[model samples]
Target: MSQKVERYYVPAQSPWPIVGAVALGMIAVGAGNYVASLPDGGGYSGYLLLAGIALLLYMLVGWFRNVIDESMSGLYSAQMDRSFKQGMAWFIFSEVMFFFAFFGALFYARMLAVPWLGGAGNNAMTHEVLWPTFEAVWPLVSTPGGTTTEAMGWGGLPLYNTIILVISSITLHVAHTSLEQDKRKPLTIWLGITILLGLAFLTLQVEEYIHAYREMGLMLSSGIYGNTFFLLTGFHGLHVTLGTIMLIVMFFRVAKGHFTPANHFGFQASSWYWHFVDVVWLCLFVFVYVL
Candidate 1:
């Protein structure tokens, strides 16, 4: 006896991606103008940015609502599962590439740029004239450009957050398994715990950011270290926020009996996104903090 493998099903059409693009346009343009107005003492163009973000968020809600309805109605076949998995894989791949870009910058600055500035490559003038005090350190705590910053060590808040996030991933997996077994209580309890862990992680992250800014005097304009640190972790946090929202939505849907064991693409997709974010955080901790 042979079991039939599932194939993916494609939907007829979706308008939300287009609407999302339009929202992105508004946001990008408004952000540009808002920044441009900073020196001139007029930054009110952020209103357009707010509008764009709101519209995009609305679009996401409507679009996901429809998909949830479809899956609950059993319109999604096993074929559709394949499609969803493939789509999530590709999305995670793209995320990997995005993080790679930041990692590439980190590597270049560490292995090449800093060393060159320290006269590692026969650039005597660079070291002697430009950077008399630079020593080509890995973290570059003190830059040749005269910016000083304290690097975060790999203990305390970060380690705790790491353990919390790992637990979150485990709880989420258990919740998914509960759903498959049609056990509502365990699913709700586990999902609720996962959400709380996520919120705790975010709270710790914000506190860390505040500590960096206040106690350490590190800032966005501090140096390249500050730049890369904030960019990598900040963007990862944004993704986590989005993932948490998705998880909350799925939590509500599950309470309403929206997904069965055989048809839970939305829940699965959100779980995949959360794991992707978790992996990204690991990379950030290694490169940005520990390494």
Candidate 2:
């Protein structure tokens, strides 16, 4: 018996990578300039930011189309599938570290910095000289600069969004199982429900932000508490938006009969991303909202 050697498929050089890099560069520069021009109301940097975003979207669509064509043409081997799996896993790991850094900052502020500023562990002179009036509360509603803001409680919109995300994860899991069982109808229905839940979460979050800004005075400039709160939640919202887009793509592919019970890595990848987003939200609810 002779062993057959499987040849690896190497794709030709593509311009999408360079396009993506340029898009990112433009976004960075545009965002920096826009922020710097905030005092003057606005500038042309906003237009550059929008253009970069449009270019990024174009690159994503083109790159994804090429990959889909290749996959549908049966150009991907088992080795190629394994490679994709590894790449996705590493990408997810990078996201994990990104969130970890934010959480670390939160922990350091809550556990160490705030306490030190409040005269904890023989720092009485430090507190007296720096911010003697600072209360050193967890939410820090009153800043040393005399700016006061209300803390966003864990009730109402936050709680509802938490429940919605939890349900979305369950519905997505059901969709995955239905796909594996070849139950197309249930799969589509559950996936659609999941997408609606995701949309609901995002909508509620927007309302929450509006309430914070209009009524509570909680904003990006509302001292340390507000800064961390917005940074963490805003970045998480961006992730949720991206995850929803991925699910929408998957939904369209499913409608076109793209995935099967046996070979559905694309679906699996999207599911994994959705689950990760759900988990991140749970953590945010606990630490950022509840605690």
Candidate 3:
């Protein structure tokens, strides 16, 4: 018997893509203008940003709903699943490169720029001529331009958040194991715990930011240290938030008995993303906090 040739699943043309593109464009423009206006009076960019976020959320809900419907209807073949896996792999790889750029910047600043500015290497003359009082230091307490700010310590909130995230990842993994074993209750409980841990971690992060700004005087303008600290931690927190939301969706799907052990690509993808975020946080804890 000859093997039957199945046709590839081709989704109908949809307006969601264009809508998503426009929403992202608006968000980019709004974010740029909002940052620019922060030093002065607030501008319309804030409203535009809100609008863009709302539109993006709307688009995401619709897109995800359509995908879920198609998946549930069994419109997806093995080839489609392979395609999704490949697409997700590329997406994660791209994300790795995105973070690499920031990490490279952190490395350059610590290894080269700071030392060069503090009268090291061939730039001793440059430092002497530009900033005679400058001194190179990790967790830079003072900038070359004389801005002083207290350093965020790794003892309390950061340590707690790290534990929370590490445990969350483990819990998510256990949830996956439970799903594979066809134990729905344990799966639901573990997934819920993971989501709660994520929420608590985010709360502590916000508290840490408040402490940094109010008590430590560590605002974004507090020099390169503050800038890098906020940029890294802030973005990580955003990822955690997104991961939490994805898990929430997964939880609902689990309740509806959507995923089978043999066919749980959605759950697997979300779990992979959550694990990735956790790994990134570990790196942040080591380099951005401990070091």
Candidate 4:
């Protein structure tokens, strides 16, 4: 007799995706309106933004629960596992492309546009007609328009945050190793510590931002340098926040005896994401702060 091949399981239509789309739409509109209203006064947009975020969170929780239940029940096959892994790989690749665009902008400004504005490429007439006193410089402390601001140094809080994130990455890797080795206690402990470290990194990042605004005079409107600095770091911080949340969810799943030594794609995906975020931060620290 021939061995039987298991039929692929197809899930029922999910309403969560459409609900998520609606939630995201509301969030975008609400956030835009809320920020636009900030110059005047508060408005209903703020409330709408909060409601959208809450609803989105709820949807995530429920959707994840259903997926977890299905996985635990062995509904997902090896092919499904491969599909999930590939999906995560592509997602991370997309993120890499997103950051690549920002880094490209930074390079274009620093290496090309700024120099072009300073009379490079036989543009002497252009500079003389425009910013006659403009000097091309890395960190660009003063704009061609004569608006001056201090460049943020790489020491102090930024250095400390770097150390924290690097350590967290190591701890998370050790946790993954422990999971592979089936050492539950070490896995839990290391994973918990990793989460705490992520939280600490976020806290220090917020403090750094506050110091930048209040003490360093580094606002989003400071100049092109400031614009690139905040947008790059701010987006990285948001990704770290999301990665931390994913790790927290994995921590709970581990506590509940969910993943085994061989089957833990969820944990593995979260780890990959956390490491990607750490790598992005390292790049930011070098390009944005040190370089």
Candidate 5:
């Protein structure tokens, strides 16, 4: 006699999901409008924006909880596991594209925009008539508009942060290894330490940003240099913030016995995301700060 295989399926109907979609749609539109209306000092629509965000987050939690329950109940089949893994891969690819767009911008600024502004190519008059003191450089410590800022050196807080993030990456990998080998205590300890390192990195980043603005006069609106600097690292910082939240969630799950050596896609996905963010920061440090 052969064992009959059964497939797991969640019925394709959830009213809460539709509600969440509408809520998120509303929040996006309302938030844009609220920001636009800020100059006029009017709009209670911001409240709608807030409510929508709250509702959307609630919906996400409920939906994920339902899925988690279904999975833990052994309802998921090998087919479902493959689907989940593929979905995660696609999500990571999308994230890579997002970062690529910014990286493209960084390259364009360094290769074209800065040089053109300093009177390269067709802008000979631009060089002779203005910004004669400018030099083509990355991170662009000074701008044609006369705003100057000290480029962060790799020797100080930035170097230390680099070391911390790199160590965190190593720790995350260690956690993954231990989880695979069924070493729960080491996995948890390493993961917890990784989370702490992430937090420390964020704290140091905040301090660096403050120091740049207050002591070095670097600001977002100062010039193209400042604009690119803040835009690149600032967006990376946002990703770090989000990755940290994911890690925190994983920590809770780890402590509550959520994942297993064989069934821990959530942990793996988070680790991948965290590593992606870490690598991006290293590029930013090398290109936008150290270089």
Candidate 6:
């Protein structure tokens, strides 16, 4: 008896990676300059940021189209499927580390740096010489430079957004279950609802930011509290936006009869990403907003 070995399909060389790198580079430079020019209004850097985002969208569409074509053409084998699973798993793990670093910074500031500055561990002289007026509060509303800002509470928009995201995750899981059962109508309806929920969350977050900056005086340049709050929430918002885009794409693909009950790794990958985003938001609500 002879055993059959599956041959893994290797994709041809592509230019999408380089394109994505260039796009990211542009976005970084643009965002840096835009932030630096803030409160004075962004100049050319804003345009550069938009251009980079456009290029990134183009790259995503093209790369996804290529992969979809290959998959639909029966070029993918079980080995390829396993490879994709591994790749997506590692990608999500990398995202976990990215958030870990941000959360670590928050913890260090709260647990160590703030206390040390306020004379917690026999550094009273240091505090006296530096800024004896410093209060060392968790949400340090007052800066060393005498700039004060109100803290954003977890009551209104933040709480609503949290509820929205939690519900979106449930809807997305229902959509995935529908896909697994080969029920296209329910899958489309549930996935569409998930996307709407994601958009609603983003909208509420934007409104919250507006209220913070305009009324609460919680600008990015406010102090350490503002810095951590914006950094964590801003990055999480970006992730939510990307996840929503992914879900939108999956919705269209489902409409085109792309995924099947047996094999739908693309849809599965998007679901994993959506769930990860939801989990991140829950953490943000707890650490950044509530506690």
The alpha-carbon lDDT assigned to residue 33 of candidate 6 equals 94
Tens-place lDDT digits, model 1, residues 1-291: 999876455676988989999998988898778756754643667898889989889998989888876776667776667877998899889989998999899899888888898788677678778767778787766765677888887797888888888899999999999989989899999999999999999999899989988888676666788778777887788788888889999889878877778777788888888888888888778878888
lDDT of each: 0.83, 0.91, 0.89, 0.90, 0.82, 0.93
State which candidate has the highest lDDT.
6
Residue pairs in candidate 2 whose N, alpha carbon or C atoms collide under 3 angstroms:
none
Clashes of 4: 0
Span of ten consecutive residues with least summed lDDT in model 5: 33-42
Give lDDT tens digits, candidate 2, residues 1-291. 999887678999999999999998998899878756764744899999889989988998899889999999999988999999999999999999999999999999999999999888988778788887777779888787898999999999999999999999999999999999999999999999999999999999999999999999998778889989988998899889889988988898889998889889999999999999999999999999899
- Across residues 29-82, which tens digit of lDDT does each residue of candidate 4 receive? 897787567547549998888888888888888898888999999999888898
For model 1 the local lDDT of residue 200 reads 93
Segments in model 6 whose C-alpha atoms lie over 4 Å from true places: none
- Which regions of candidate 2 fall more than 4 Å away from where they truly are? 35-40
Q: What is the lDDT, from 0 to 100, of the residue 60 in candidate 4? A: 82
Off by over 4 Å in 3: 39-41
Indicate the TM-score of model 2. Answer: 0.95
Q: Please say which candidate is ahead in TM-score: 1 or 4.
A: 4
Ten residues in sequence with the least summed lDDT for candidate 4: 33-42
The lowest-lDDT stretch of 10 consecutive residues in candidate 2 is 34-43
- Order of quality (lDDT): 6, 2, 4, 3, 1, 5
State in Å the error of residue 3, model 5: 7.6
Query: Candidate 5: TM-score?
Result: 0.82
Tell me the deviation in Å of residue 8 in model 1: 8.5
Report clashes for each candidate as comma-separated counts: 3, 0, 0, 0, 0, 0
Candidates in order, TM-scores: namely 0.88, 0.95, 0.96, 0.92, 0.82, 0.98
